[model samples]
Target: MTLDRRTFLGTAAVATLAAPMVRAQGKPKVVVIGGGAGGATAARYIAKDSDGAIDVTLVEPTRKYYTCFFSNLYIGGFRDLASIGHTYGTLASDYGINVVHDWAVGVDRDAMTVTLTGGDTLPYDKLILSPGIDFVDGAVPGWDITAQNAMPHAYKAGSQSELLKAQVEAMPEGGLYAMVAPPNPYRCPPGPYERISMVAHVLKQTNPSAKILIVDPKQSFSKQALFEEGWQKHYGGMVERIGPDFGGANVSVNPDEMTVDIDGAVEKVDVCNVIPAMKAGRIAELAGVTDGNWAPVNASDMSTKADPDVYVLGDASAQGDMPKSGFSANSQAKVCANAVRGALTGSRVFPAKYANTCWSLIDENDGVKVGATYEATPDKIAKVDGFISQTGEDADLRKATYEESVGWYAGITADMFG
Candidate 1:
């Protein structure tokens, strides 16, 4: 069997036994929804490991998948939009997997079929939902998807990232830039903070006098100390944050007016980045698997608690301890692929292990990271060990950390698409 660099790294750690699969009449069908880190990786791994033993179909609307991870760097001018975009051509041409570019509008659990917006229904023995996240209604009063353009979230990457960057560049001299950070359990714990660093980097070079204001509901956040230290050192007095004590939790926005009302104090700003409360994508709720917000899954295999044949990965799954990150989704995909393949093709199933790392760039050649190792227990995916960059790290170490993230991005994309 052949494996790519990312594939080898994920599978080399696992020990398995190859058991002969018992084929009844035809191959078992596997249908996967979404094409981001989790779904794409799962589709690739299942097709590769099964070696034509299972029929895999990937359902996603976009031809090119844009990563939410590292998008802040793009906003900060570290990378172009093209570098983070990936397509499914290789998965279709090389893996012999059927790729359907359509929105999965419905899922019938009793009939075990998926309905697409194109008026087509696909039958499947097993289904994988990795549709990422969607904002909750009334998450932020006076803001909805219609207001996305004026107050762009840029959380899903792609065009939103581009729009946010363009808006930042077009800001007037000494303009105020505000960000309403999301609450906990959102995609990428440090994402909003990382974005702040990126925005500050751009403002420093272009509009030196422009200031950034953060309206955060949480009292503390991931890598708070590291981010605060970097902000003071690199862009001192240019950034201010209002935590819950300052009524950051109570916020509303008027996209037309370009104003943020925090705790009844209205602040006019040139640009507003609103990241509201989030939940699993709509498809998970449609499939009857989600427990209100996220799908609960078995830690050992990532199978949804609602149904044995349905598996949810990435930001959509309530897997304990792991932050919702691109690296985390990719990690969960491999474990899920192993279990799904074993169930269908009678292949070797190994115990589940997961890992994730989130790297953020504070300034030129300055990077910080947080990560952990997880193992499956009877209850959830429990954290075993973890590591994070310290507050006063040397410049050389920070640069090395940034470079490591670049390499990981290249490798993980290959593992997902190919």
Candidate 2:
């Protein structure tokens, strides 16, 4: 029997049993929805760790996934779309995962089956939901899908990202680029700032006369000091930030008009990226797994509060103190995978350590990162020690860190998809 890297990592930590002994007459069927950071990891781990004792199926609309982690680089012209986009062909060909290319329309929790948009129903003994997030329609009034055609959010990862990049490229040399940052509890706390940094990097070369404005609802943000320092040092006078004190710059937008009403002041811009407030994907609501915007789950195993056999990870799950980032989602998926394995095989699940490190580019050669490890308590996730990054120590170290981020992306994508 051949095992892929994902399966090998999952099974390597477990004690070995005879192959025949592990095989059951009828193995438990696990169906996972979404194949982004969380769902892909959980599906791969369950199939791999069970060592042919579990039947795993993954349902996702796209055959390829483009990560938001390094997408800023793509916007800044450092990386290409192909480099960031990954395929699940490896997951299907190497790991024996039944990859279903379809959108899940609804989930029938009572029947324990997932209903597809095409009218097929997949029954599962255990289901994992990690559908990521969706934009809140009315969070910013006047912003809808049609309006998004003119002003791109570029938050979701694929076409939107490309559209934003195209708009930025087509901008006049002295034009303005405005990005409205969403409120808290959104995916990637530091993402908007990093996006500004990358866009500034591009403007520095192409459109030095252009300026970037960030209209934020909050005064303070993640990595505030570092980002400010970088902006002053690298792209001084080219970037401006208006926080809550300045009337919050809170606005209802008119996407069709390409205009925003900020605190009774209406302004029109050449390019706008309105990142709306977010919630767990619609599937969470359909499954009755969400409380408000997020799915409540046990911190220990990531099992849903509504159903113990159903686990939720990724941006959709409510993890206290941990921001919604891909690295965090990947770590949570591993813990959830272990918990599901324990429940299926009647084995003990030891306490696990979750680690997350997210790197943001301050410029092409400079970067900053925040990392932490956590121990799961009964109700919430508590941070552990020994999780810090190198401060403004040396120029050489910053350059090396930027290079390391590329390696991390490769390693993480391999861990999740390989």
Candidate 3:
């Protein structure tokens, strides 16, 4: 039998299982929705450290999980799609977690249970909701989920990424490539810019005469100067960014016509990537944990402000001072795991300290990053200190930064899946 990476990891770990199964004895139950960074890490830590004291179950609809981190590299031709795909086998067999591949359609807070789309009710003592994000309805005029096939967001990081890559690769020489950037507080502050950089890289080599336009609703963006510098250095005279003051505010896309309307000015494009405004995923809304667009959580332990037993993490969470990046989600998961275990078993819970680093690849072996360490405060997660890639960094330092990102990807995926 040819065991894949996931199968091998699961089988190897299970062969040496030492922890006893205590689920039949009615241990404290923890159910985590969404098997992304937050939910996967939380479930694994809760089950692994509990020593059969907790029954951990993770519910995610997808069989294969793709990390949004480094997905831009896939589009940039720096990575293969399979390199970023992960499986839940380790979480199930190795960590003694009940991995349920089903959508959690509703949460019955009063009943202390979650309702699955298949008509099953899962009772839990504590619930962790990390259902990522969902685009707002009609956030982009003439564009919605239905139009995704034509104007790809590629934010979800799978086939969409491949689609966008194909669209860009197929553009004719001297063609136009346009991107509609999202508003504030979306996932990955530096994401759209990094994508633009990657797109420009591909175009620079394939069709130098092609043009790339970024229509941004905000006047400024994360690591703006650094990206602008990189754009100028690597793909000069090919990229243009229009801020809100310049008609970026009023934008509409016609997927059928491959047209973009910016404040009554229309432009036709060869390729369009429309990233609409987003909020917490539908499961979070169904769980009744969201305030406006995001779920508000206590800074101390990521517990939802609505219900203490329920917690929210990752892009769905509005915890302050942390960008909605995979690193942030993974960091929050560890903290939440510790808190949940302490609440269940009287374990010592330390004060919550979190950190996140968002790295973007501007070109081959060239990267930029922004990061900070955070501490939980009475109101929110406040930044203690932060740092960013300075503009005009030397080539060696940029190469090192890009290498560090490669190492981080390997380490983080191992930490999450294994």
TM-score of each: 0.97, 0.94, 0.94
The parts of candidate 2 lying over 4 Å away from their true place are 1-25, 386-391
Task: Write down the lDDT of every candidate, Cα atoms only.
Answer: 0.92, 0.83, 0.90
Q: What are the clash counts of all predictions, listed in order? A: 0, 0, 0
Write one digit per residue (lDDT tens) for candidate 3, span 249-317. 899999999999999999999999999999999999988889869999999999999999999999999
- What C-alpha lDDT does candidate 1 achieve relative to the native structure? 0.92
Better TM-score candidate (1, 3): 1
Order the candidate numbers by lDDT, best to worst. Answer: 1, 3, 2
RMSD of each: 2.4, 3.6, 5.0
Model 3 misplaced stretches (Cα beyond 4 Å)? 1-25
Q: For candidate 2, lDDT tens digit of each residue in 1-418?
A: 1234444355434333323323366788889999988999888877777776778899999988999889988998889999999999988988889999998988888899999988999998889999999988788878877778788888888888899999988889799898889998899988999999988888889999999988899879888888888899899999998888885546778877777778888877889998989999989888999997999988898899999878888899986767799988988888888877777765557676687777888887887787887888887877885443444647777777777777777777887898
RMSD of 3: 5.0
Cα deviation of 231, candidate 1, in Å: 0.4
What is the lDDT, from 0 to 100, of the residue 69 in candidate 2? 86
Give the Å shift of residue 371 in candidate 3. Answer: 0.3
Please give the distance, in angstroms, between residue 69's alpha carbon in candidate 1 and its true position after superposition.
Answer: 0.7
